[model samples]
Target: MKKITRKKHLEMRLQSIPSHPKPKVGLEQYTTPSVIASDLVWNAFSLGDIEDNVIVDLGCGTGVFAIASALMGANSSVGVDIDEDSIALALSVKDKLNVDNVDFVVSDICDFNQPLDADTVFQNPPFGSQRRAESGQDLKFVKKAISLDPKVLYSFHMASTEEFLIKFYSDNNLEITHIFRYNFPIPKIYDFHSKEKADVDVIVIRAELK
Candidate 1:
């Protein structure tokens, strides 16, 4: 297989990973745009954290980061999600793309305590804004990643919570590294959505263990 050395090619490949067929409002199931996922994964690859590493994507909706890491030559990529429906979709795409290194597990992020030699973790967990999900759900993912003892973590959160997240991560022995900001588009998937699409300021923080 040819290596994906360019960002555009990797983004094009990630576009094949489909979104949730029936998004649940409670899960905050907005798909991370291929553009954003590609950029983040590419940066991780460039930083020497992805290629040939054991990659884990927590709360992976459709396995965007997992599949991207596989394409970028990760040793293995594991995508975990509580929703079986989403995992099913991820499996189908993995098979469709013949990506052998990428795998999916259907389990709640908090209940995921496998002894994975996780080298790096990429998570875009729920922002915890939905009443159905407990607030600070993203923090749970951070703790889980820390427990996995990965060398690095990349997580996304609302830009509004940047200060809180930085302090929380520092308190937990995670050293602040890079902050990548973007205007994430939220499509009108739920009835409560008032616009066709709205942009929310989001930040993807890259942190390493202290």
Candidate 2:
């Protein structure tokens, strides 16, 4: 099968998400959802992931996953997010791609309309609460993915979250298919002027929907 890739185009879009109020500790920056999405997409495609599969991307910050799915020949790809700006940017990219296989919607993952037809889900939910300071937000996303009963689910999370996440999903009956670790660049405000940047280790978890 032929592979497709879309270039990142969210210069203005990134500006609209609103900068973090304070610097993130350890890593001064957080990874962009697009990078996370691309990493997931490449890995998924390498597994002979699926052709004409229904794919849903939750917390699709920039729609890279959604667009890549459509490009990869998924019968349908939908990206869902709570942020209006992010959704708008994603939609814009969707139009630019001119691929009818994908769509974007603005909604929270928990209450968003479920794609009963999807066989796979690709997501990069907030690694933690980061700006919001909430713990275990990844669990909420995992449960939601299982609720869809996809054959496979891919997610990017904090490396430190591995043990906690592994136990959490194991308790919930989800099995870890694979785990990939890499240095992830996190973007955040630094110093009094909020200009410094930092990179940290991030682990991407692949789990089978059992």
Candidate 3:
């Protein structure tokens, strides 16, 4: 398909996905904007490394990463999440984008099996602050990705969690190559005061498997 047609189709698919106030179990309900999606797309595309290599996005909220990877010429892309609603929305977006190179599945990261040899993996996991009791759940996703032998681009909370994530990556034999920092604006959750406070920053780290 022509690039323009593909672009328009993706735009429509993005519109189809439900925004905030809709809940997806095991996944936070942050409606990522086009700018953030583009940033992730560029990061993941840069890690393509080889032409037609496979890319996967763990906890792919709405399939933006997968969609962008397909557009950037990855041989194939897959997005895995436990949220059925998210899976449905992502599939709809794929149809609109006319991107047949990408697909999505509903599954938890811990229970996943590496069905394909992925050259790169991208992920935006939960900060594990809101409802998750564990403060370092994000690292599990990265660890699992590394175990699958894929270079990863992972988003994390830019607070003290940065140190924890760095150490975890190092321990797992993953090398951090680049860090993209941004102030992430989060929504006001139920009875959460800091939810509106801009105390939280975000960092996207690019890491390679050893």
Candidate 4:
């Protein structure tokens, strides 16, 4: 099979991948749109973070980022998620596509300690929009990513929290290298959704350990 070299090709591959069967609102389970995922993965690849590198995607919903990294020439990619259903779907897609460089594990971010020494950490974690109890979920992912001590990290967050995230990263000794803004499209998946589709402002932060 030919490698996925272009962003469009990568997006096409990801477009067919299935999403969670029953998305949980509290977990903020929304599939990352193919266009956004493609842009983020291609940008990381161009930054020398994906090709020939080991990557880990925390809170990986259906393994979009991890699988993309594998397709883009990562030496290996691991996706960890708390949802078993999501992991199962990700594994099925990996098998159907015959992608051998990526693996998916069902584990909560808090309990995940697999001795990972990844070169890059790519994650689209929960933006903490739904449940009030899960407000700081993104911060947990950030702290865990930092614990892995990767050379680079790409994390998605609500654009409104940019200032807070800047301070948070500074306190954690992580430097924000770049921030890419995107209008994330959220389809009405739950009963509480007021619109058929809502565009949310999000920022993908590229950070490095200081």
lDDT of 1 by residue, 1-210 (tens): 688989999999988888789998878898999999999999999999998899999999989999999999999999999999999999999998889999999999888987789999999999854445678878888998899999999999989999999899999999989999988998888888778988888999999998
Collision count for each candidate, in order? 0, 4, 1, 0
Who is ahead in TM-score, 2 or 4? Answer: 4
lDDT of each: 0.91, 0.68, 0.70, 0.91
Compose the digit string of candidate 4's lDDT tens values, residues 1-210. 578877898999989888688998778899999899999999999999999999999999899999999999999999999998899999999998889999999999888899867999988888865545368788889999988989999999999999999999999999999999999998889988888998889999999999
Show where candidate 3 strays beyond 4 Å: 3-21, 24-26, 47-51, 129-133, 189-199
Q: What's the lDDT for residue 72 in model 4?
A: 93
For each candidate, give its TM-score against the true structure: 0.97, 0.79, 0.82, 0.97
Residue-pair clashes, model 3? 1
* Model 1 spans > 4 angstroms off: 129-133
Instruction: Score residue 150 of candidate 1 by CA lDDT.
Output: 96
Candidate 3 on 65-127: residue-level lDDT in tens? 777767777889999988887888888878876889898988988998957788878777876
Global lDDT of model 1: 0.91
| Candidate 4 to truth, TM | 0.97
Q: So what's the TM-score on candidate 1? A: 0.97
**Rank by lDDT, descending?**
1, 4, 3, 2
